[model samples]
Target chain A: MEKLTIIKVGGKIVEEADTLNQLLDNFSALPGYKLLVHGGGRSATKLAAQLGIESQMVNGRRITDAETLKVVTMVYGGLVNKNIVAGLQAKGVNAIGLTGADLNVIRSVKRPVKDVDYGFVGDVEAVNGEMLASLIHQNIVPVMAPLTHDGKGNMLNTNADTIAGETAKALAKLFDVTLVYCFEKKGVLRDADDDDSVIPVITPELFRQYVVEGVIQGGMIPKLENSFSAVEAGVSRVIITLASAINQDAGTVIKK
Target chain B: MEKLTIIKVGGKIVEEADTLNQLLDNFSALPGYKLLVHGGGRSATKLAAQLGIESQMVNGRRITDAETLKVVTMVYGGLVNKNIVAGLQAKGVNAIGLTGADLNVIRSVKRPVKDVDYGFVGDVEAVNGEMLASLIHQNIVPVMAPLTHDGKGNMLNTNADTIAGETAKALAKLFDVTLVYCFEKKGVLRDADDDDSVIPVITPELFRQYVVEGVIQGGMIPKLENSFSAVEAGVSRVIITLASAINQDAGTVIKK
Candidate 1:
């Protein structure tokens, strides 16, 4: 059974208490065939501002300077992780929120930048699928946050999409499930303004064409890249869709 | 295979970082099996004071009023939990910190006082052995903190020792391990002042005899009670010893 659905949830999708609860409810009713990876970028940025600290971003990823790293670690791995775990458990989802730091489930090498070395941000190097599959096999849904550690014992800020991709590939190698990428938008679209123009399917060539034609750019770039990575890494199928479309079948499917 | 070990660590264990690190380094390397259950009572008390809130205690248990509950939950379950997890992981120990609120591993029943209601303090009613054994079997140490919730979704302040006892009982039903209740004292003794007079062993009858004779009084009473409870629940053995003796074989072993 080498199949799994890796679902990546964006912070915006979980902004309100009701939305988070509703999402968990939909997830609980899901066919017990998916794993979830979550992002908390907006929440971390907002909290850092409230705490009077400036968050630095290089490209779309956070530049984890010491101060910013601490805030994000505490918020992403601690506060938001637990809240999501509690929320899903409240909805009878049997969710366990874990960080890459736990069980050394995900490991990485720390990336230091000019003068300002990020005290604890690492680029993920490995994913421990055995540990994760054991939990999922026992009927527990994992709610993973975007954080990993250097194998040498330092924490790091990682891209949630990348984490989800790696996790999808890992789970795909381990079980039979689906990989779902959930965001605020209503799936991939041919026309950005028309929500009804959802792309039903995508191929690697179509993806490149869409990017060059300006139909898929910005956030969609990394997501598509992640989807392609998962597909390449043995995940049989990948879904790029909206959270609202979880119970429906309106998301774009990427498969061989 | 009804064997179990319950190790109780105090909040002061983390307050003294160097000493705590040394202890963790030694404890993590111990040859036999073990599980660590910890208390953050002192931190909860201190944070409650700093917040200008009145702290309440009943029979040495912190009465978890709403404000105090919030402080303890954030400090113990968040900061303290992560600190220990980080420390253990740093030492190459695969320690996973869990709250009773997570996975419903340790469930409780709210025990509000007759006259004055303690907002969220509970007495242990159940322990999910299947969930625990799965983790332990995978070689991941379960580092439990005493913040649980009733199944109805309300949080509760549970006694750390009680949680440890229930956990030991659960593990005892699945594996052969000793339950060591470590604290500040060298060991339970006939006389309080003589550290050298550490009681080597005691049976259920002898423990009762000591209590009736006014030998085991005050703080030792609850610990002894927890020990006896674990013994009755099929744990292979119980020991009341100091944290410093974790690496050493110096402790009072309580047997069936």
Candidate 2:
């Protein structure tokens, strides 16, 4: 099987011009087949505020109301995604921007109302790996926006990490998939205050030990969990690292 | 050669839900390979006003300064494009949204300043017909946004009509292409005041005569010129018609 790298970057790295340029440079230089899944929540929030739409959040997760969904769609699928595609094109990479609805690559169900009504949010139901592999074979690098559809004309806000993990898991069947979660941090740290105290490798047992030791807490917990899940689902490797270090071997590698 | 239909729709038709749904229904019912080029200027203007960004227009063309470019990107590439893609998917059409920058499908030069500087505005230099044909062969209907790139990092505001015309012209080499311009009007009218006075069949000589006489004036001039250009470029036909009449074969058909 051919090796494919699936990189998921957060809004901060992609929002600014300089960082995004650097990130794209690294991404363009990456070997073999590649796909990018991105988040633009910060931009969405800012634009929502500018539009005077109140953003609602519950337990650190966004409550994507109708207006908020529109903002996210514009930011993630439009502004940020296009910028990346254009940048990569400038660098001679054949990057194509997409939402889950495009080609029906990802089908998601609207999250049912339970304790909280996360309006217009979607939990992914399927990732069409065959269609994606077809695109990859044609050398088209898909820049996926963190948006999914219910196959009934409704676009839903989705989590970028989940998109990356789910996409990696699905593609793992056809390729040697490596899912990389790129952000501002160097890697998972041994001490919260020390940036140099990066943990080079982590197994399932090590991940549990780190969680019990309180070194990995909050948002990082769910991210790491998603990474482990990808590894368990037959993905070859999962890396959590800085966006700038994408081409380098300088991140916490997760394995089964 | 296989027949391909390229439809260009105005922003007004896509801005509202009712009209958009109707247009999508009409579009979905069309036969053979199809592509859609759309405008979202109204949505951009609305979002710009809400964000306190003053939209500057010179002679009915937008001055795409940095701020206005962001607004347009968000509106056209993000909100409008995604909605159409998701809607088409709901109707079981394998639709993918694209800008010129995606896959380097359309490469343009930044419009040079002479009388006025239209910042970030691009004049298309080339269209990659082969790449488009590849996607079309895979049964993916592309929903194009009115955006292009300069083969550099810059994303430029382009005209929807121009995109549609250029794409049709390029695809003409591989497919028997029919370019359709759908708007509120029924067709190119003989009488400006009467909607029923549509000129049914317009040849190049008749088009020139209409322009010489005062029947074809203002915006209709350039539209007709584009239509004639498409015919010259080997496109099988160019139809200017109402959005609802797409599948009905009711419109002004331009021929050599």
User: What lDDT does the true structure give each of the candidates?
Assistant: 0.75, 0.93
Q: Pick out the ten consecutive residues of candidate 1 chain B with the lowest summed lDDT.
A: B1-10
| Per-candidate clash tally | 18, 0
Per-model TM values vs. the true structure: 0.86, 0.98
Error of 1 at A215 (Å): 2.3
Each prediction's fraction of true contacts recovered:
0.18, 0.93
lDDT of 2 by residue, B1-256 (tens): 9999999999999989998999999999999999999999999999999988898999788999999999999999999999999999999999999999998989999999999999999999999999999999988999999999999888999999899999999999999999999967899999989999989999989988998999999999888888899999999999999998999879899999
Best by TM-score: 2
Candidate 2 chain A least-lDDT 10 residues: A52-61
The candidate that wins on lDDT is 2
Across residues A1-256, which tens digit of lDDT does each residue of candidate 1 receive?
A: 7445567888877656677777777776677556778878887897668657788776666767676765666567655666667666666767676778777778877875666555466777889998898877777778887887664545678888888878877777777657888866677888888987888898899898898999988878877787787788888878877886687787898876
Give the poorly placed runs of model 1, Cα more than 4 Å off: A41-74, A90-92, A114-116, B41-74, B90-92, B153-155, B189-197, B202-215
Model 2 C-alpha lDDT per residue in residues A1-256, reported as the tens digit of each score: 8999999999999998898899999999999999999988889889888888988889767899888999999999999999999999999889999899999999999999999999999999999999999999999999999999999998999999889999999999999999999967789999879998899999989989988989888888877888888999999999989999999999899998
DockQ for each numbered candidate: 0.32, 0.91
Cα error of candidate 1 at position A64, Å: 4.3
Off by over 4 Å in 2: none
